[model samples]
Target chain A: MIGDSVPQGDNEAAAREVASGPVIHIRNLRKEYTSVAGVIPVLHGLNIEVMPSEFVAIMGASGSGKSTLMNILGCLDIATSGSYLLNGHDVAVLDRDTLAHLRNDLIGFVFQGFNLLPRASLLDNVALPLVYSKVSREEREARANEMLGKVGLAKYRDSQPNQISGGQQQRVAIARALVNRPQLLLADEPTGNLDSHTGNEIMNLFKELNERDGITIVLITHEVEVAAYAHRLVRLADGHIVYDGSSHEGAMSKNPTEYSAAVHSTS
Target chain B: MIGAMLNEAWVSMWANRLRTILTMLGMVIGVSAVIIMQAVGQGAQQEVQESIESMGSNLLMVLPGSSTSGGGVRMGAGALSTLTTNDAEAIEELPTVAGAAPSVSDVAQVIYGARNWSTQITGTTPSYFSVRNWDFAAGAPFTDTDLRSVTRVAILGKTVVDNLFGDENPVGKIIRIKNSPYVVLGVLSAKGQSLMGRDQDDAILIPITTVQRKLASNQVAGSVRFIMVQVKSAEAMPKAEQDIVDLLRQRHRIREGAENDFTVRNLTAMANTAAETTAVMSLMLGIIASISLLVGGIGIMNIMLVSVTERTREIGIRMAIGARSRDILLQFLLEAIIISIFGCLIGVILGIGGALAASGMTGIRVVITISSILLAFTVAAAVGVFFGWYPARQAARLRPIDALRFQ
Candidate 1:
């Protein structure tokens, strides 16, 4: 009812009226893959805007253009024909170096694979982003330790990634993602490789960080339970946004029983 | 930024310790080979010059006719007595000529009491001692008056003194030469060996008057074997040689374009020839050794290429974390420089040790020059950069997405 009451232009105009615009603003975003079979369009005129301090989960099945959308949002890939402005900077027009700087200064990424440098200790792995920021060694170590403490991996500061369990490795990755104090956290299936219990813990951690620290989080997942943790739910189908509303309303209206535990806990 | 990159490079090196050491071995051998070869060559050249100088740098031997044989008899240079006492006197008057000695040598049996020895007998004046730079071990040389009066006073060389006198005082003793008794005047100082490997100390010195009047009176009067002329300085040798030739030609009344029946032997020329040969030899050896340095550079390039390919994932992670292309390039380039510098330092120590060892084994002195060490060090660093560039570029050019996906 709220989506039907307002026109798309009026919604975008409202979003732009805020003191600081949305963290992510895209209009008519499209991406096509050029292979031996010519061009295959993945995302077709997809547009989404996430305001500051909001937790949103993008849910989609395979070939639903969710991953491609995440990549474009993360500045790792460019859109074919569209406008994506991240934090008031037009990402499509930015050069490679500027994109790298934007990523370093504002964006943090956590992958499902728990991409921690294997040889680096837990502390070093977290502190790596600051090395590029030119932070002093002592300060980097202190900040990294503080972040590790937040993730409850303070005792494993010197332990290598391989020496830790899968759940602990994910915690270390989370610590690394927050060590730079990035405003935008982009997680592509952050707990895809973890067990169900560990996945619940990670989701709770993400919920706590978004609620307490006011860090905007954009997570991509196919799991209905994972989507239930976010306040806003966005579902992609056939490279187009089919649903965007409160997770509680979406869960109850679409498939309530399957994500009932996630819905009840979050509500 | 540099410090951070260096730290990272250091970490990488330690992570692959065996590979680092193996890569450095090639540089070490290359640098040490260059250093040792240069040291040994320079040392040999120095030894040759020193031995030549010891033989006397300012000496010139004016012989009869040319040294080469025209008729196949090979009678040896200075066989004809074209030189005379008057010719020696004329040469001594020249401003560039310091001194001149006219003398003749013969192998003869000299007996002193029960000890008898066959030795070379050179009969000349006291000026021969000063001209030859000879010193006395005991007593004094025969005076000029001894030559004028044909006195049979002799000076015994160290070898002759040891042979005939058996460490006894040879001065004021009498020795018989050609059955003629000559009183021993003094002993000449020990001269180990001549340039020709002759035993210079196993000889005797006496008055020229005694040589012609008493020893070889049957030959032409005042006939000299050769004239030993000492130039005032090495710089004056060419002028003195020319002056002596002009003067000798006029004195001999030889016509223009005719053979003057004399030759002047320049000892410095001989020294220069020997020096040039050694220098050229060392240069060739240095070039041969430098090939290994090139090979070492190639080895570095090879290792760097492998490193770039093997660490592709690591490179991607760093790029994703915010490392610029330049940062990745700097990390690898700095790593190569560190390895090369480490190899250079170790190679210098090894090279000096090798040179010393070679010297001990061969009994040849090796001179290590600072220039060679610096050159080898600079080359080692350059080899790292020259060879590391292509691989570092390859690593830097890798796309983050592609590298991350690379297994």
Candidate 2:
């Protein structure tokens, strides 16, 4: 099925084999923090794999370790045990410089807080990642504009983050993430800070990227309705994965529209 | 990448408009004060040196004074009248001596028409103006014929011309000095005011022979107040002064252990002392100016740290979006340097204005050298880099997860 999704050619097959081997491969990953009282464990040896072109959502209640796993996968934090392989690079053994390069080349992130630089315009915010990549200014601007257009924020490219609505800001964040063209898109509660309608729109954009451009996306959310937008859903409870399968047979089998409506009315 | 970082810094500063403006204000005032004080001090020193140079470089002055005893008691010793026209003649014979003149000055009330003015009348020989380097604005100086014949003639300085003559031409006009009528032969050029705020061009010059013969007969001939000797070259001034001193001492029949009655002062030594004093003052002023720049640098550091703290989440976001620690550091550092450099540029403008204004008000010459401007700018940039480093490092050291979690 993954081969069928790839373009026809020996070069395309090689690219497919590399991409589908698992952009994110985790094995018994664990994270803990030392508090004033004692050591506090967050993720208890969680294991997961995300293939190419896959749209997956990790859902759980508050403090269910889903966010902790997302952080480790995004390279923002390191695991306390086991290992994480991102694009076949061992993240645990990489130095700070290589980790930075890995984050820039392989991972794109969307946050719950939108995290757009408040002082920068939408286009400048999107072009920020390319700054570290040493890309030319013209290319950076062009790619930033293209990303903004893809996210339907072209007209508001010059607007500061505060000038736009929350939904528009999220779209800007999305464009910034896609501008780098990373192998994996990791989103930590992306819709957690937004209204339901805006959340749905963002998820729909992610869906389009997955279907049309074969960009892999891994999103973290507590709400089951938000998870239904992903083709695969993983449930976590008590710092461990409880279920991992196709979304249609498990969480998505429930009435997701009612849940979305409930969240919208409350918002 | 540097461009993008610089742009980020610029935008961040503009976002908090009031803070940035206030910080810039500190830098502007600090830099302006430094440049202005330096310029003013330099102007004053240059003015003093120029004034001293105008008096003549190799001229030496001999004044009469005796060493005081303990408890400031006056000694009943007979006065030594060693300095005379013969001594002036002897010094003039020296190959190194260009010219020598004897001068006597006394305060006198001059009456001309309805106007009365109190002025110093300097009784001097024909060579006084040449030895002293005085220039005339109109007419001519006293001739040897006038000096030998004891003619009642005078030369008026600019202040005297303006005071007694007003709009009328003072040359060839008659003025009464001590109730004796004297014709003004010439008007001296304006010499401006001295550092002590004394009007330099306020005195009148008359032939010494005439003062001794007609105006003040009690004042003995060849017993003038002081003698001024001009040397042909600056290098020969010391030897000329020494020869004059030795001849005067021998003529007075002074013992080997006795102090000479008259003291000879070399113009070069006097000018050097004045320059050293002014140089010390300039150094002190420069140090004070540099303190303000230091304070400005501290202000930048303080503001940058606050900015970093305020934008914790933004730092986290940038990190997540592929910004390295060095990138954050470079951006913030560049922002601080830009502000300081801009402030320094504005300071140069204000400093030039201050220098020109001081020159106009005090008649002092101020030169704004390009090296001073370049040095100030370079120091300002260095200050920015030095002070901005800590804050940038603090921002860069923040962990992405912890920063994002910061409320």
Candidate 3:
């Protein structure tokens, strides 16, 4: 009984290594917007990859093209140039219906504003995506309740978004993102609107989700403190990747003097 | 999906209760007005038709003049006194004729003690009561003996009885008609006013011999002023009229194609003319009411456009959540339609109530046909669809990114 429960660690590890390959693959993706001021280039040929079970953060200033890249990865917008292979499928070549299906089936989004419908209950907010997929009401309710339970919000399922605190709303948003059990979670500035303490708590929750449930998380933020929590950090400036490495290594290489000085200064 | 859309529409409408009610007000009033107006018009027409028919369907009235006469001047093609007892007898002998009565009318002031009432005095034969569908409430009609003896016995109408006798019976009582004392032998039953505002029971009836002897003796020649004829049935009216015309023409020694001295009109022709007039009135009212409905539809469209602008972000979110353009279009269009249909329903109820109230107040009979209600409601719904389409399509065609970015 013990052997069956353990399930042969070596084989399991080998299967995990093969199954946890790159879930998001981006190669020289570009996006441009035409305005009255002529064409504005937002994302200038950016390349990146996100593996399963990896928690990565893309850090940039405002208008640094992080949002454009996130939108393309989430299938909310299409890239004007290059290929985006999400979950082993080329999203650039897919039709609108296929892209929508991919977004519904493979990716879940959590916005900075927590984008819960103000008129709907927390449970209903979580179930909206499932509604678009034509899921049965009974199944949707069951799944939504289950997800709310996971986020410690089972009692607050009937409460509206306005009734909850900022942290609680974000928790509900995270639960909504995980309702379909998608391969990738794209959270854009998830804790940008929260206080420092609540932001830290939310970051810890994300770390716990990555470690315990092995869900791949890609978050975009401008805050250095928030980006430090991810396993990998990709820094961008002027729509180009200035640095991409382990969080500690990127911090050290980008500003070694500040990193050591902060350590020393704090002590 | 439809149920969900309806639920969404209902919730949203109630969410903004004041706006919803205001929007529906136009439809309600428009619908109610249409129904009430139609009811009142139809009731008036019905009342006119009923009065005309009750006068006797086959009866013909031989007025002394033609309608085409210029300047309202009296012109006698002949003496106009050619309508006589002999002519009445000749008409009565026709195979299609049921009865014929010669009549002459004069306005008089009758004094009963201190109360003097002005009323019409009509001298007519015994067949007049049957031909004009008059029923006596008390006493009895004059007999042939009264006509032969020129007896001063009279039949008072309901109004005359009320004025002259109060609560007491007027039968066997004498009232002075222009200084001549006449006994009231009978009182006619109540006949309501006609559509033209004529009081049907505001006169007194006397024997033709009495009027010729006592009141209008100076104006008399060998004939009465007019002859009233009743045919056996409505189907035989035309034949009866033609036969009377032929008999009168032969009696007066008129040439072929010569215009007769009098004009005869049957109850059917009168009823048909009244119906035509009412139809025109109703058509005009309907056109006016339809214009109001159109205005209400335009109001709906204006409000829907405002709603689209206000809910731009929500629309974007829905589109981003994988809603197709058609889905968005249907949602908003359904919202507009739902509002319009609700307004129409309320309007229909109000309209029916108003019509009933008007009918009750005016003593008229209103017929509310199912087709009218269906027509009004269908028009309202179509107005919703027609007006709401542009705004809904505009909302649907908006790019998700642009809508989301809209402040």
Instruction: Give the candidate number with the greatest DockQ.
Output: 2
Local distance difference test scores for all models: 0.84, 0.80, 0.80
Candidate 3 chain A: worst-modelled 10 consecutive residues by lDDT? A1-10
What is the lDDT, from 0 to 100, of the residue A18 in candidate 3? 39
Task: Write candidate 3's Cα lDDT for A1-267 as tens digits.
Answer: 111121222322423433555888877777889889998988777778888999999988888889888888887788889788786677767765555555656677888888777777899888776766667788989999999998899999999899999999999988888887777788999999999999998889899989999889999998888889999988776676767778877754554222222222222
Which pairs, if any, clash in model 2? none
Give candidate 2's total backbone clashes.
0
What does DockQ come to for candidate 3? 0.24
Per-residue error for B290 in candidate 2, Å, reads 1.8
lDDT for position B18 in model 1: 97
Task: List all candidate RMSDs to the true structure.
Answer: 7.6, 6.6, 7.9
Clashing pairs in 1: B65-B261
**Model 1 spans with C-alpha error above 4 angstroms:** A1-19, A30-45, A61-65, A235-267, B66-81, B101-226, B233-237
Question: How many Å off is the CA of B304 in candidate 2?
Answer: 0.6
lDDT of 2 by residue, A1-267 (tens): 221211212322333446758888887778898999899988877677788889998888888888888888988888999889876667887765556666776688888888887777888889988888788999999999999999988998888899998888888988888887878888888888889998899889889999998899999988888888899987777686667777765585432332222222322
Query: How would the candidate models be sorted by DockQ, starting from the highest?
Result: 2, 1, 3
Choose 1 or 3, whichever is better by lDDT.
Answer: 1
- Sort the candidates on TM-score, descending order: 2, 1, 3
Give the range where candidate 3 chain B is weakest over 10 consecutive residues by summed lDDT. Answer: B61-70
Report the TM-score of chain B alone for all candidates: 0.80, 0.89, 0.85
The candidate, 1 or 3, that scores higher on DockQ is 1
